[model samples]
Target: MKNRPFRERMGFALEGIRTGWRREASFRTQTMLAGCALLALLVLRPAPIWWGLVAVTCALVLALELLNSAMEAVIDLLHPGIHPSIKIAKDMLAGAVLTISAAALVVGVAMVVATGPAFLAEIGL
Candidate 1:
């Protein structure tokens, strides 16, 4: 796998994203939020650092969501029955998503706070 060509690896990665989009409502929802954040970045015209922060944070959140979904799918396939350990694993995955989401939210707010006034003045507000 490590020896696979970059293009092939990318295709596999994209397939994972497509699978996540199809099977995970949370992934779709997070993707939409990321899109909205990107749109805000475009409109607000924030500093370069804010752009990087928002992009990286959005990517991290989305990537984690995908990982969570994948892990849940595998767990379901392997364990098909309810067990305390499986339950805890799934719960922790959900918790990870929640934590990243909160961070993303902070980035969003800070972006707006740091750039909103400049954007408003630019619009003669």
Candidate 2:
């Protein structure tokens, strides 16, 4: 890849996000869920290591979603007509996203369990 200025690179990345938001429902859903997780983290004020794990896991899930979107776009462009190989490739890309998403779900649950009691008590639960 050509080394470009930071601002220019950010513009391209932002465009990708815009496209994904418009084209991929799953992307939007995952982003919303991640946002909620971050909000919970802010409320809980978890340990630094927990924050690191949440950040990394969220990033990984989002990155894999972007990759899956990119792959689907390319596959459709190259083979609009049905083919078994293309189907397999698309399925595998989706599977990768699903696997990462499942891992993120586990991390999210752990975070809630670790902090839920304190948060609930603060709310007079």
Candidate 3:
């Protein structure tokens, strides 16, 4: 197939986002969590390295989720009925998501703890 123009490519990407946001609760929830993390980062304004770690962790979680969603869709299309191998594949993908999410949680918590009293003060709590 011929390569599409940049605008068309972006439109297709946006459509994917719209479809995922509408169809996948996990996607929507993760997106909200990421947004909150970003807001926290802005408020905390930690060291430069911490910013990079947090950004990468958030991106990794979101990207893994999109891949998992795509995998589930393809698997369902190919195997509508239950099958052991299909179940394993889906389970592994979910496991990968869980692993990354846990990593992201760790990064987020570490940042919060490292910020310590300043974080609490920043929130005026």
Name the lDDT of candidate 2.
0.91
User: Over all chains combined, what TM-score does candidate 3 have?
Assistant: 0.88
The 10-residue segment of model 1 with minimum total lDDT is 1-10
Please provide, for model 3 over 15-119, each residue's C-alpha lDDT reduced to its tens digit, 9 standing for 90 to 100: 887888888999999999999999988888888888899999988988899889989999999899999999999999999999999999999999989986787
Please provide, for model 1 over 1-125, each residue's C-alpha lDDT reduced to its tens digit, 9 standing for 90 to 100.
57899999999999999999998899999999999998998899998999899999999999999999989989999999999999999999999999999999999998899899999999999
Model 2, runs deviating above 4 Å: 121-125
> Cα deviation in Å at residue 55, candidate 3?
1.5
Cα error of candidate 1 at position 34, Å: 0.5
lDDT of 2 by residue, 8-51 (tens): 99999999999999999989999998998899789888788889
Question: Residue-pair clashes per candidate, as listed?
Answer: 0, 0, 0
**Runs in model 1 with CA error above 4 Å?**
none
lDDT of 1 at 97: 96
Candidate lDDT (C-alpha), each: 0.95, 0.91, 0.91
Q: lDDT, candidate 3, residue 37?
A: 92
lDDT of 1 at 11: 97
